[model samples]
Target: MHDFLVDLLICPKCYGELDWQIEQRSLNHIEKGEARCQVCHTSYPVQDGIGYFLLPDSGREDLWQEVDSHLVQHLQQNPEIEKRLMGVPLETLSPADQFFRAMVHEEREEFELAEESQSVANSGIYTDAYLSCWQSQTKYLMDRLASNDKPLIDLASGRGYLVEKLAQNHDFPIVATDFSPKVMRRNRRWFEYLGISDRVSLLAFDATKMPFKDASLEIMTSNLGLPNIKGPSELLHELRRVLAGRFMSITHFYPVDDNQNRELLRQANLETMLVRDLASAAFEQSGLQVEFTNICLSLAEPTPVGVVLEGAGIDALPVAETNLEWCLLEAQQSSKAKH
Candidate 1:
């Protein structure tokens, strides 16, 4: 974690300021340390320059745990280059996608052992959608926000693509927060590998209960992560509580036209609508004004599941266009609460 960002962190349980104790440091990077909440006396560990301001358990256990375990094992074997990517095995892609693919590769065995076997399909979709969305808009969003001098936080940063980009291109302080330690660990390594660890800070914290004081953050962002969250309303409220400047996000929205698309939305707890409807509802709920909104077709091709349309032949499969809808929303503080 960066030395300056330590002042902005608070205890999620009591909302009190955190007192950080540094055990190891390299310039601005705190390689090993601990953060103790002054009010509640709860202590959170800082590992590999990333602070984990999260609960003992976030109740999420699955392929990620397996992936982290595997990575930890690999790191143990190659301690010399653990912080650097010199010894890590990754495929050819953007650094973020390479880390993601590495995680998926490491977790395959444990994924097969799971009772439901959803990880296989979910991981593929996740990789495709995130790569597509990032390639499509994340850099553009960062470019728009880069001119601002205020501190920026990337909420639910899946693989820290924006974080890396912003850190490399700008001098302003940047922080990346995610609920998964495994993902953040990869992010820390990536930063180290790219020689930008001093420019970025990583934290593991729940989105619903971020460890920041009210209005402490100037800008917040998330790319293709809001829909996976269970409660959009609560998240928006939390964003409003912590963000004093702007909140921008890129989400995958599907237009519920066909039965297959509708079913997909139902399973994901999503609704189909125009890009404006989604942006308006989100901004209204968060008490933020919609400053900008952009809609575009998804770059990933939809994989057909071979379901026949209602009016088609009995043996025919419905040829539906991809339900993937890519949307961008830029919102800022509003005086009046629309909801």
Candidate 2:
């Protein structure tokens, strides 16, 4: 669920209060219920666990129906996964981790699926888009290196996309760490496939409790990876403790806005010296100084018509879209002088 939906729990059209119906859980059957708008008497269907406030028989019904059907089917197929996901304390988990777990649950069935099945190779839809976006960011970072020999670390690096890209051009030692052994194994396979197994090292480490000494790292990068981090504040402190020079992270706008984001950082006692946008912010809050901040537009191209048609095997194509975007950020970090 996006932040917008979380905040606005009422029906958009009728301005009615909505409630969750737990009994009628089947996807195939349209769950009968009503969201009575207190003011407008506009009753909306609470079908398939989603509260639809829009006009009945509107163009959006099909879309909402599909989404509700998918949700119901998924929950039914994987009750254990659903229970585990729903059991997480939303307020306690970092916004990033909450979002990460949501994505992981949606895709991987609570990380119980085999690594090979969940690997990028199996998901052409995600692989193409993810590779394109990260490749652009990696090339941009490479341009900034400018003959400098700095050891780089990728925290929570799943499948090692950025590390693999960096190894292709730079000879610097790159370490990719994640908590999942299954993910790390897949990452190692990618490294081997690219013939850069020796250049990149894969380690199993928790984001909150990194296995590195103080002032050991020059550059640290987490690409939309840290949000799935539990105890984000502690994780930030750990990142600061390990970094000798700089730390850069790309995250999402969850728990929405800078205030909530900063609250988490401050709780960890991090001093965010610079903030670029809702998507990214740089913390010199740990007594570090910011050297540079770059915000670039990163985009992913849509699957070509031929590929989509071939994959779907449908000449009658529905309106299709891609997950392209322009929200990319990079920050440079350095140590600050003590008073």
The candidate maximizing TM-score is 1
Best by lDDT: 1
Per-residue CA lDDT of candidate 2, range 1-339, in tens?
A: 111222223444443454433345333322344545555555555433333344443332242321333434655687775555445554343333343334445343343322322343223433354555545655666676657576677877876656766788888767677765445555555565568766665554466655455566677777667555565456666666666666665432222233644465446533222223322333445444533333333223233222211232211211233232322344333324333
lDDT of 1 by residue, 1-339 (tens): 887778778898778888888999988778888889888898888887888888655675431352446444665576663434323333223333333334544344332222122333334334465455656676677678757887788888876766777788888878888888878877776676678877788888889888888888878888766765667677777888888787887765555455675565556565422234664777676687765455565544443221111121211111245545566677777878523
| Displacement of the residue 12 alpha carbon in candidate 1, Å | 1.0
Local error of candidate 1 at residue 263 (angstroms): 2.0
Model 1 lDDT-worst window of ten? 306-315
What's the CA RMSD for each of the models? 9.5, 20.0
